[model samples]
Target chain A: MSDTTDLPAPSLDVEGWTCPAPLRDRPRVVMGHGGGGALSAELVQQIFAPSYGGEALSQMGDAAVLSLGGARLAFSTDSYVVRPLFFPGGSIGDLAVNGTVNDLAMSGARAAYLSCGFILEEGVELDTVTRVAEALGAAARTAGVEVATGDTKVVEAGHGDGIYLNTAGIGVVPAGVDLRPQRVVPGDVVIVSGAIGVHGVAIMSVREGLEFGVEIESDCAALGGLVEAMLAVTPDLHVLRDPTRGGLAASLNEIAAASGAGVVIRERDVPVPPAVANACAILGLDPMYIANEGKLVAFVPREHADAVLAAMRAHPLGTDAAIIGEAVDSHPGMLVARTGLGGTRVVDLPLGEQLPRIC
Target chain B: MSDTTDLPAPSLDVEGWTCPAPLRDRPRVVMGHGGGGALSAELVQQIFAPSYGGEALSQMGDAAVLSLGGARLAFSTDSYVVRPLFFPGGSIGDLAVNGTVNDLAMSGARAAYLSCGFILEEGVELDTVTRVAEALGAAARTAGVEVATGDTKVVEAGHGDGIYLNTAGIGVVPAGVDLRPQRVVPGDVVIVSGAIGVHGVAIMSVREGLEFGVEIESDCAALGGLVEAMLAVTPDLHVLRDPTRGGLAASLNEIAAASGAGVVIRERDVPVPPAVANACAILGLDPMYIANEGKLVAFVPREHADAVLAAMRAHPLGTDAAIIGEAVDSHPGMLVARTGLGGTRVVDLPLGEQLPRIC
Candidate 1:
């Protein structure tokens, strides 16, 4: 774990958070606080976790697995604030449904129902709201989950972006399926499903009005089916994570830190689409640090690696899945990439998002 | 249902909503769409309901009751955008927790877990966020529920109010309890747990800088315990509703319409705090149209009315509980209130909120 010896002493009192000096000397909330990076992790660890102390919250998983009335349930929530309501492959509507579904899927659950909350800007066209809602309804149908309950609130025109949607989902975890970062061991195999950086690059292209030879659309699709295929191979998979905000690099760092295991990946084996690679190269962005909405990184036991890879490849969403690396005993809690040029370099968890609201 | 003879024909083969001409010539969402009144209902029936098209959603209860994994569950969501964040006796944080809890309680369920999503404006004080988190934590504890999972997103400073919170709650329904508006019968007795209009007046006083003779603190408390006590008396109660947003009038109208029953309430028997009544008189607002956070309106069988009121009064949050009305066979699908001067007046749902952002 990163050293906290230089940090101020934490004061656990009932009043409020008065200890653990403000992150990076910034006492006010910055955009990075929502970037799903180091700043986001710090905010949870220092403020939220301490205030809302519980074993479930402390687990720090994509979704909280709870035993309720003899049922193993997975619950997750996400808010979509991506600017420009519609993107190339999907809108905030798709993300609102599929994002929460993927979070539960990462916990080895199939989502049953979702609750949607809409915060609309007053004077927004009724037509725009209709399009988003229709998209949301269609996405839920595709993911096999129902949008069962909802709330709508409108803010005066200037107080909000056109639309912000929050979806909280509930799912049932099949018996004998257990997933958590702590289960990762030194010999664990790391695999990624499909390409990275396409989503972030696509958002950038549209937001900045850049022409990159060929059009790139977000690889945004629900990953529940892919996850189910992998689980069908073996229920003993160590961990599964959807690399959305901080991308594959962030997910790897989180797993390494939580399990106290080092991760080493072969740079040449990591998948990157040609269009995304070209756009990132021109923009000076690292594909590893970019976001992917419909992709996942998995840590599986070495024994089940080949079989799981075969299962993933048979699935449509995972045709390009590949085994890129493995966990190691050296440099616990750190990630190192074996470069294609026969050298190695450390891949640190991003401090903040290189592309904000890409999801 | 209100006559739809003059409404435009609905086209189900939709690219988008092409039916029911805009509400009263309005082509865009207005403040009334969030006011929990006629406009809010129209938005749901015309747009959200048709787009979503699910049985649970069509039930239109405070929470959706579902059966998942052989267990009965109540799921609900609400977004809080109250201005000033802090109000008398509570803040947006308290409502974020208690509001969803009460929604579940209205479904006769004890909330087990809640998922919170925060939309923060960039540049907001960390201290402010801390205080809100603390309040949320404390409120969850008071209600005996866990804040299990959460997500946060940020927008530039101008794009959002200080902080908007959306909470989705999951609760387990007791074995034999069934509560819905459709169950109300002509002879059902109407009872309210406590005084009305205090919450709306308290918010208005602070928001408008009006000094009433006495300080009216919001009656904002979790109603799970109160609900449990009432259920202990009889799980056969016809319906339960928290008079929030459009308040008692809106709730009564909904029940009347859903069950095809008429309601007649005695104004003298309706418990209204003197301060709240005086404030409403001066503000020219009707107590029936004002909101209450900690109170509930219940339609009980005439035979069990006395027992339920006694059980409610025995609980701390229900000391002022009173039987103020009854369902009647006359004037089906309408609400009529008897004034103290022996005159009857029809109480219609407010077109919009008299006080917006009052939570």
Candidate 2:
């Protein structure tokens, strides 16, 4: 008689039988699956998109713009799992509010209400919870949105970290405003709201106990007002992105791939703070792949580039706005940066983030 | 001079300095804070309500009803942290979709779109994630709602359980259909759809490894269709509640307190399946306090109760629907149950759930 028990269980041989187009080589979820990079996109496209089987989710915008009851609505959700709940300039509470708000703003919508879901760990101090709650309330007020509804759940002490918050927001899209990657044209001008890599460096400084001479605080703020200011210049803006998890490079790559266009930026023109650059050099990380919370990358019509930049500069949140790139007819679905030494280099989408939990 | 190093830090004196009305005696969050009972209500009223500072949240309904761009919208959110991601008859995926759908239905709205947020623990099997996603997609299709947008984040292996899902739904409330606690009045009949205690019992069976003669599956389902049938009988439903987390007892106590009315139910009229009853009896748990995911407790006008009951009976989800109680003018803000032995007893809101992570 054959020894059946000695053989591998049928379920254990999942790789041998199951189709692996979506999951590819990995049979287990890794940090990269949530890092908003190539793996993240693959997971969404192969698994989530096919499973959902809906046009709305397939749009893959920062927020889904939908028409309901004759109203144009923007809906989005984001979960905050950043370690060290309290950072230099903000906390998870602020990100919980601002992150979703910025997502709606990316679709040219004015966020109106937010739904907060909190998962708390058992035995976490009440004062700690209160502090986080207070910060969230303050951030919502500052963003001009209401925390209208909420749900709370708790897990056993070891089963959860101190707190993980998920915020889903709803907003109203203006009558004539439409922002999507497909709107990009070859002559479009690309503008960035401010310096990159500050938020990521600030987080690393705290988590790794590495400090430069100057204090680097997170650039965490709601960008609804900044977007409104840009829209005031002209609602004909092509696209907008918050450049979060996978940073500027991921945003550019996604836009290029979605729109089937080429994105070119001048490396000398891309603003990077001295402290952030020093920190990245020491850590052997690229600033292009570091995350940012309170910044936006916009593709606008060439005719309105200067006017939009001027308006963004007038807004308090966008004082550092700069036009650093333009869409190109060549190299479709690719991002290229012109080095300071006058050489062109492809800036590919990151395979994973340099640091996890930098959001 | 006495050594000052032994003195306690001022921050440690949270009990002595901070106003204690909201937090009351507890210095840290307990499992009860997420139990959907007295502690949950206290957390909302004292902490979340004040922090939010808005009237929409004060309604304390299953969903927040709001007017956006001349369209009446109902928005609600819930986080599912049930242990053992998969259970009999349902999984967290099913609950993630149906729970939010039912919340909107309670407000007389037809859910249109849902936002799903997933916090996955790193190293979880890809097949497991795929199964959960497939279940979520199937449930959304069955509920006739679209999963429009989603966000995913991963925590380190030990920092989380297998998976935690949060779903937020948006729906449009039909015109002239206004449901709220204040609309409830004396002589209003309370009706319960199907049986209670099945879901909780099923979870306990797996967790405790206790086997009954018959398998008791969770009563988890989407109630939008059953609710639509009920509304055809009368557009004016005083209030509706899904008996989840804290079960029928908690739902009744909340309605009684919110509407400032007395609730009286005949214990024999409350439906409890034999298998569930047997499991609960062996486990020393009360059927009234056990959770039911696929059931609802609704208060309707007595004049329309018979028609509503008929409508409910014709639907697949409400086959066992029955009128179990009525609101009374005397003993406001209390729930009283008449036992089978011809005695009345006060059914107070549970301090916490009889079982944690029941939903």
Candidate 3:
């Protein structure tokens, strides 16, 4: 793991083990379980077991563990609160699942089970809740995992911000997995997971006032498969990072600081569809620092960059994957991007409020 | 554990357990760890070990198991938020630790370690935060457990309802432990850990508009010792319950319903300090349903009732402990109280609201 990567490829065999218990067909989530009493046990016993993926996890115990086979595990948690509930690509439920799973992948580990805690507003439609949860189950299945166990609490309308989803993930980083920002050497190459600003632009277009009529759907999808492809080909990945809230620029700057290395990104090498670029221009927003729900940045050793990118772009999820920059020792702990005209500037964390609650 | 009769007994041994790594002097919690990142590791490294108790708990794993030599385990999570942060006799910090410990104790489990999560509003006074945290540490020490690994997140101001505290506990109920509601037999006796309503009234007195001066203070202290005392005297205790939110009345109703039995209470046998009664009268509040942060209600076998009560009263923390009622098959699933006037009526879970979030 190095400073410039967001999604790293690491080998892991999470198979064979399975949870035999099945999910009960409860009409909907009842208040009893959330009340911290008996009903909660039934939910855990029935619904939780089927989706949990393993007997160890289905034990209804407090936490989870991964048999990393003597590997260091990467763990991460993210809470999703994307408004408009339903979106072009997915809902908050699915997003929550993929987002945390992707985070662990970025750490060069095989993502396993996740703990989901949902804070739902009291009046949310039961159908809507079921749909979102089903979406989560579907996404978890697609990524070869399970919903496992969860906690659902409904707050009196105002106290809750509609729906808040907290997802914590555990991934096993294999024995030979070496990932860190500090691995970003002077000549390391940077690769973009796909089109950089599509996800962010798509979100902005749906905002109350920034209504855009174009087909700008968020590129939100689980990246574990794509990462698996890359790892199958190369395990010596540098740093993998999801360019979430602060986007590409923030991601780059953080990597630089973390690795104590300098980063040089070429604006020309970055891929941005005309519609996304145009939308960013119209909205006066920098695509580099916008939030991207389904994207990650990776810094890899230069010699293996082409092979890694080729492995990535072969997957449908990474058709637009491309090399964006290289890591250097100069400007240590900072990032300098060469604009279209070769002009360089620094990218930093947001100075003030930039669409608060975007995450 | 039974509905209210099974009082917890502390383990006499504390040897041959896995010790955790040394603690770090982490000054403040960083954001990345809360992101489910490596920073979270730093937190676990620096803060968890020293304060953490129990071999199974110190591994910093998801959940721990007790050798109990085969004791059934009871787990519970509680979040504490008391305005003014500190009240007379106890602070939210102490209350947070004690509250869950008691819940686990009530379930007949000898509490081992606690996992605490703090949601700190940004820009909170450093001194205040540290003090509150230190108080938590000190109390855990007194209770003979480690704080264990904890998660801390600094939400932007106003996002929090003050410094919120969530503590999840792990305890082992000895092999023969069977404290479930069903054990509330017809002649079982009910014993309280101490006086009730004192905690709720103390908070009210400190709050604005309900201002009244008296020597009344919170009775918020861990009841593990007292539980152990009673449990040692009588292992046949049937049920153990903490009368928290909705207070004694709500707790009684819940127990009655859970055990599919009825409970009869004698008003004269209940213990209520004169000051708490006066404050409730002045505020037009009912002392019966007011919360008690530190007390518990225990139901013991008739043969052991006197011995358990004597043992409870012998502990300083349970000086006011008293036998207040008897469980019965009559009035199935209801709580009937014989008032001072010799009349009995139903006491049930409030139809709607009854002092929300008292703990």
Candidate 4:
């Protein structure tokens, strides 16, 4: 376990951000704000939701649930700007599919269709584009969804990365399944679907040119099947989240804020594969704040926790699923973790991501 | 009318395209390739469609129509990369809402909800973003649609332009309205909603720093309400298309190709506001190939042409709408225009966009 005294302050100004603070407190967007942390939350609440005002925008779920005609549907969109298009086990294409699918799945929706929008940089190899498309198609097939529609735009060279992909997904939420962060309650069991931090570490390994002497492939797989398995156990799941940008700590913090509940977890109970642990130790990073593409953290009522965990473990994507913590009445909207040495330390949302574009 | 002797060959390689012609003809994407012209069609049919194949993608309509549960829904997406985020009558915000709304409207769907994904540069002014968002909210209210969900991503300053917005829309396709390109018949009449060239001229006036004495504001208004008005006139509206990138000529050519029919139009009958005509004449740009954000071309049965024209004219957006052309069997999958001097000329899609990033 990481030493509590040696830990840096949770809040720190992000480096390499050159935007002028135009607003009173902060005028420009910082990398931490996009890291799905407190800054990101403030951005959405203060800017996006107020500007794009609607009942749905205020819902603040992974996907917005809406009723069209008499049927309920989940709609979501995400833009992927990961630096290296291809990493150890996945590419931007896989992330595009899995990210949106997981989002819809988190809402207890069956991801049925998706739209792929590609912004290709001029002079990119046709072969490279075809490869990414193939990966996208394969990932969509794996997730049991179809690429229903698409648009393409090209930018001048040097104006864009090699390629950026935006995917908008539509899924059907089953009747009687209502999942939202506010549904989380004190005494709800918090479960991690599998080993965390694999996805972020994998990207960093390739980007930073570090060799951990062991290949740490990205856990960038679709979690729809695992989510479906859990739903099969019960539609009463309180909350579900895929820790992507700001990692497990951010997701837990968001839920705590949304539900007005406190969360306490055992540091050792969170599953971190040996490779990820070694990488984090060497890099002086915390696995709790590292992103994970394929993993999910579920908040379930204690009574249903056992059944859900069994169902998740039975699925291929959740072999390492573990119950890491439980919601508490104390310290509402705060998160604390018990260290391996039996010391309790506050686990705050990182001001910004330790790694940028780790998605 | 352009002199026949002065017309350049339509098949020449686009200048500044650096890729070698290894896969069929064009190897790299030219500006015109994204212009919704023949090049855009090839990119979709040969590249995107083949790569991301599915039943819905093969439909190739303005939006993908899918039956989710018992409700039929129209889904569409578009990315706005229009330079100079703020323009005369509209900004990227207005374009983002209206463009996707228009896409859904073209399919005879009343746009209900939209998803916005913004890729912002790090150093862009917060005030600029807030202004754009306000414009977007206002436009959505005008169109009777809600911005339900949104995503924001910040890229490093040099890697991106100030901002690019992508909106994906969902609308419920009403029963009994079947609108698609393939539904156009040989005797169909082509009706354009409002005057041509205003939008393109408006963008160019600001971008190129030119003025034509009179201000040319973009016709960047949502066409959904106008479409609903037409649908009330008749549920059997044949085909609808917003002439955006690549403009009217590209749209007519695409409809021709899709329906396997020929189109013939009276060049003088097509309405071009005097300001736009003068601007185009000075810029040496064919008004036919310039972009429009708030205009649409409809293919309707000749028998209903008069009634449809009346309905379109009654709507505020279509007050200047005019019947520009007709479908014919003379030259299958081709477009021709009759000059006032009694000469007929083939109208070819531009090899590349004359203006890049003009929405």
Quality of model 4 by C-alpha lDDT: 0.84
Candidate 4 lDDT over residue span B203-239, tens digit each: 8899989989899999999998899988888888889
User: lDDT per model, in order?
Assistant: 0.87, 0.87, 0.62, 0.84
Docking class of 1: acceptable
Tally clashes: model 3: 44
Candidate 1 displacement at residue A260 in angstroms? 1.0
Runs of candidate 3 exceeding 4 Å displacement: A1-192, A213-215, A218-240, A263-275, A297-328, A338-344, B1-191, B211-215, B220-241, B259-269, B282-285, B297-332, B338-344, B357-359
Error of 2 at A7 (Å): 19
**On a 0 to 1 TM-score scale, where does candidate 3 land against the true structure?**
0.62
Candidate 2 lDDT over A1-359, as tens digits, reads: 13553332222111121122345557677777778887777778878877875988988999999988778999999999998999989999999999999999999998999999989888777778888988999999999999888999978777888999999999999989999999999999999999998888899899989978899999999999999999999999999999998889999999999999999999989999999999988877778888999999999999999999999999998888999999999999999999999999999887656677776
- Cα-based TM-score, every candidate: 0.94, 0.94, 0.62, 0.94
For candidate 3, chain B by itself scores a TM value of 0.79
Candidate 2: the clashing residue pairs are none
All predictions: root-mean-square deviation over Cα? Answer: 6.5, 5.4, 17.3, 6.1
For each model in turn, which proportion of the native inter-chain contacts is also found? 0.68, 0.68, 0.00, 0.57
Of the pair 2 and 3, which is ahead by DockQ? 2
lDDT of 2 by residue, B1-359 (tens): 13452221122111221122245556677777788877788888777777765777777899999988778999999999998899999899999999999999999998999999989888787778889999999999999999999998878778889889999999999887998878889999999999999998889888778898888888889999999999988898889999898889999999999899999999999998999888877876778888889899999999999999999989999999999999999999999999999999998787667778876
A127, model 3: CA deviation in Å?
Answer: 7.8
By DockQ, the candidates rank as 2, 1, 4, 3
Clashing pairs in 1: none
